[model samples]
Target: MAKPARIRLAGTIAATALCAAAATEAAAQTPPDDSIVLNQQLQLGDVFSHQTLNVVDAQEQVTVSTSAQGNSASGAVENGSITVQSDQDMRGDAVAGTDMTFGGDTWGVVNATTQAQGNYLAVSAYDSDLTVDATQSNTGSLVSATSQLGDDDARLLGGAYINASAISNTVAMYGEGSFVGGTIDQSSSATVRAYNRIETQYIPAEAVIDSQAIVNAVQVTSGQTSGQNLAIVQTSTGAFVEAESSANSGNAWDLAGRARATANQAVLYNEGGSVVADSRQDNTAFVRAAATTTAFDFGRAEAHARGAANELSIGNNDIYVEIDNSQFNSGGVDVTATFSGANGYDVYVGADAVGNSVIGYSCSDCGGYLEARNSQTNDGDVSARADTTVAGSTRAVITGANSVGNSATFHVSRPSH
Candidate 1:
């Protein structure tokens, strides 16, 4: 649950020396050892390595996220490699809601959120990565909140949200709980509340979310994920990977909802309200919990909607909202591979991977997809895979292998309503 970054000039600085002063501060903040710590110091923010770290902490209790709640919203782009690392043996507020990145093999990352008080919020991405990462033990909470007030004839909306994406880049994140996810909920509602318990997914080229689109008096929430989990990894591109033998990762996404856009509304009084939630996660990038090790990550979503109240309420009232959670862990190899390669020959994947599987499946409210496969024996492109419910979890497991290693159990819980 990261917020939009807070950037303000406290004291006045000579504009002429701003560059020199900033450089000096960045240099002084470098870690003595290769190890680093990312902490959010209460309400004032934290002091950290500015050169290698980039954070986005934005909060709008009144209106909009980091976007235009009326029309369209977008994210910026980076042109170099980057690395995100967090070391926490204990699962406290070591590095709560924050984003930090250094230079490396990966390039470009985006974290975006939006709300539409007029119609519906639209989300799309291209040539970059959009996701959320979480790794925790014992217990933790990550939350994001957005709000909309007043009344209008914007009760329900309709449309198609995405098309295609372009790109070229790599990514890597290491720590206790590692997770990567991109989700969108589009279920129509009517009975004063909309229901969104369906996920229509397809990955002929890349892992994507495309469902029915609409806007209305609907509120959506996600990620109230909780569980015990763990992930240990050791990956590299050298000759061979030598170390242990057991590797494991667990992950989850809970998509539950329902929506009704056009229903019987006795406008004489009111038209009710609409609510939705999607893809809740519970896991970490790296860590060792006291009670368990099989780190867990989760994401939950639901939606309810209806048409604008006609002459009933003297007028019509409508609210539209949309959201998605993005994440990734590895050399940006496991998950990024699924998003980049069109040929499907994940050439760089190596070793005995436990919970590093890409699940691109969806079902109606009645069915689910849960599967777990062990490839450590032969160990093909990847190591393991599982098909559970929309309530999916991502846990990592690494053996002694040649590549980048990441162990995580991240609970990236950010609910916006």
Candidate 2:
């Protein structure tokens, strides 16, 4: 009688295991119809997320998302602790997602979008210390983002002792409209570091499409500042698209731009250890690094871009169209960001509307562009170091434009190395 009962119990347990396995396989990460999710946990060690959505369709989407103070910190700790906090809120009737059709019906939506980030923190409770109180608070409602159409964007960043990486791409159409808009916004990326603290940001405003109007302003700096860079353009009719991107390697290099900008920066500047750094951007970008505030001291930034629009069909694409779009562009060999530091630099004044793209080259799109149109365009670059340290640099311009369609196009590059 005991043997028979034991056998029966084992069989029941086996059946339950099989049902549980089937349920797990059929499950999906589907949130509520109108959902509000809050997940708070202290996860020490490794973490990962994998999402795959096939032939999806979504539209009339009113997306009011706020992810402020989303940060991470990791490194060698001898009897220490790591803490991260975030607070965010949204208000008002913003003119967004109205009459806006993101992914239309019968329109296969494959959103293969990825935004990657990294944080490096080192602590020695017995010898040294590091404190990171990164906070950004907004008490009153202010209309900072407004009147945006097509592909418009805005970003703000701050922190200390970090490793960051970023990539962005946009195609009027890619892979049969499947990947029409592949924008990795921060919507962008960064890799920075400091044993004690390091603060850096690469802010770029961009827009694309026909009958579209775009205006961009950016500010980057460190300590005191007295430097200028200019890029001006005068157009004459037709399609007038422009993009100005910048990259830097110095522990402190002030930048100001009035157009689109981007970078894949990696810094390996060590004070009392060995460090090696590598920054890469490819077709299907995948970046993974385990570096240090070690001993190696090296950094580099390179950039590249190409544009084309064969809209010679009818007289539809009218008006002035300027593009400050950045996609799959790369900055030179290696970058240096001190993963470990004893003292941090206090930023004083960082201005906006700054540039002179470098360590990279940009190619102009052609085949009879801006035909029979009035255009006055200007592109100028100015660099002011303001009595600071300078590093390696290079500038490349593809001269001899075929014919600018009775238009004025000015190009200038000034490197303050």
Candidate 3:
């Protein structure tokens, strides 16, 4: 009718330019020996009106590659928001070959009544010569509220690797929140090789009326076998709180390690409140080895009219090597506390061990205050152990080497005036 409708719109624009030139020559080739490669990006913004609310953003990226032998590569990202002002960023990458495997992941969220912020990053790399296994992971979260006030922030980073001959590496990070006054930070780092195994972690909880929950974590590894490294931070508040965890290792043999920091506070009319927890570990081992490090710091405070005070700490340190038939085993520092109103308290626990055959323990409780400390040192046929328990009003003190299959127990209930 009009010249055959202009030849059917010129054959649908020449088949959409030959399907966008075959998707740009299959994204410029290179990834085909039993192949798989992927790339992804997503962004969403726009939803406002509740007395002028604006600015919501999201971003993501993923890349993957695989070659032969049951090949696999994966990348993922998810982001969310409800805003007066909110921001988010996510990144991921994966590569594999020769009995190949790779995975990268990222998740993010932002809910703002006034302001919110988030950032997440993930990287995975494995180029095999055969026998290559690799994994990388990252997680994130953020929330903010302001009727006339603002601020909220979150960050996470992960890295994984396998560069030849028996490689297994893993890195992890996690975050959580609820804010009315802002300020929160979480961190993670990891490296792996040689009898490969490495882990890094951060756990977060925040309830802000005046805001504060900050955490920093670090993990590293290379060469000389054996594995395990952990860091944990827990927080709850009506006011102030702080937490910390630090770990280091190399040349490890049969090692189990831990670091924990915790805080809890409740204030209705405010009389005073503060809480802190810190854990640290350093390791080197050989000669029939076993190494254990535990550091736990806990705090609790509650106030209705007057008195409210709490502080707790735990520290364990080890440097290893026990020869002459070898066998160096050490577990040091454990501290715990539980407290209730109308004040009256002080508690501390400490344990230390060094070289040639050692074992140790330390415990503490406040609310009927209690303390325990144990230590061991040097040479062959060396042994030291201690245990203490106090329900209320029990006191203990013990010192060093050959406490001869040691034991100490105490229980006291206070309510007799």
Candidate 4:
């Protein structure tokens, strides 16, 4: 009774409906062992997990978390084009342009996000580590990451613009073991901005016996240079060293070292290094923006020798400091000895020469012996009266209202050494 054209049309509709049902059932099954190749299009539900996704060789489009999971959703277009409607947390490695919008928290450990030419962003990790360990043949640009390590003994290494919010507290034995080690080299620029605090637990025997710890922060900016830019050392016996441009580069060295509440029992040495500003031009080297370029800064080169019979040496034309903010044992002779700087400023030179400058002031509660030399060309201003002492040696040029030039004066008593 039906026409031939109508019969054919009915059969086509039935076939299409059956195919759609079958596809839905297939998606509900376990994740595909191989790659989820979609030549046309594919849509997924709210949950996606326990799957290793490889998008490097994909030319198709696949969307996940369409509707809404709780109050948020996530879907990725290309490598970097990942979008999230609400707050979401992603834990894994994603390529460039994996656009992500999280209304909550993200933690990243051993993850790599490379931004070839466009913009990129990454966030948090639990036990995962994010590594951006690229070679000299690679070029990375416009990459931004905000990361936090929530588990103990976790590490995050590599890349630029990296924000590390936390370090682990678990005990582990290995060389160069820190909660975080961010290494950005080979013409790389890294900026670590954080709003939270990073904590690390102390290991007694392993830390106390180690002579020197290569423990510091690596942070560099603007110029292309090798090694670390910023270095921060928190625990154990280690030296926090940061180096920028070379002294012979004819340019100002962009190097800085900052520390607070760092406890250690370490021995450090500065063999024959010099911190010289380009006397050729009005260039600036070893400067403090908090003070300015011309303030004649102190402690550009610092040494922390805080143990029994420890020694700290500073070369000529170097800034050295020894901050004593640790719980030291009694009868332990922690020495902070400084060599003179270049230009005859070695240990506070005369008006014609730039000698070493000593600035020591202690509160009444701070109990330590304060000694200074070459106060004649400089003034020894002591505010606290806790029996301070400044003994000028035979080879030492001691002055002030008390010695050499009327420039050196020390109110603290000293035993004639």
Q: Give the TM-score of each candidate.
A: 0.18, 0.18, 0.19, 0.19
Candidate 4 lDDT score at position 211: 14
Task: Pick the lDDT winner.
Answer: 3
TM-score of 2: 0.18
Candidate-wise lDDT, in order: 0.18, 0.19, 0.20, 0.18
1-417 per-residue lDDT for model 3 (tens digits): 999999999999999999999988997784433222232222223211112222222233212222111111233211211111111111211111122111222122211112111122222212211111112121222111112111112111222121111001112211111101111122211111011112212102111111111112112111112111222121211121111111111211111221121121111000011111121211111111111221121121111000011111221111211111112122221222211112112222222212221122111222332233323232222122222222334223222222221122323233231
Candidate 3: which pairs clash? Answer: none
Question: Which RMSD does model 4 reach against the true structure?
Answer: 26.3
RMSD, each candidate, Å? Answer: 27.7, 25.4, 24.9, 26.3
Model 1 lDDT at residue 300: 24
Error of 1 at 61 (Å): 21
What is the C-alpha lDDT profile of model 4 across 94-142, one tens digit per residue? Answer: 1122221111112222232211111111221122221222111011111
| Residue lDDT tens for model 2, 1-417 | 999999999999999999998877766454323212222222222222222222113332222221111223322212223222222221111111111112222122111112221221121221112122211111111111111111111111110111111111110100110100111111121121111111122211111110111111111111111111111111111112222222221232222111111222211111111111111211111111111111011121111221111101111011211222112211211111112212222211111221211121111221112222222111322111111121322222111111111122222122221
| lDDT-sorted candidate list, best first | 3, 2, 1, 4
RMSD in angstroms, candidate 1? 27.7
Candidate 3 lDDT at 51 equals 26
* Model 2 spans with C-alpha error above 4 angstroms: 1-260, 283-417
After the best TM-score superposition of candidate 2, give how far the Cα of residue 52 lies from its true spot, in angstroms: 35
TM-score of 4: 0.19
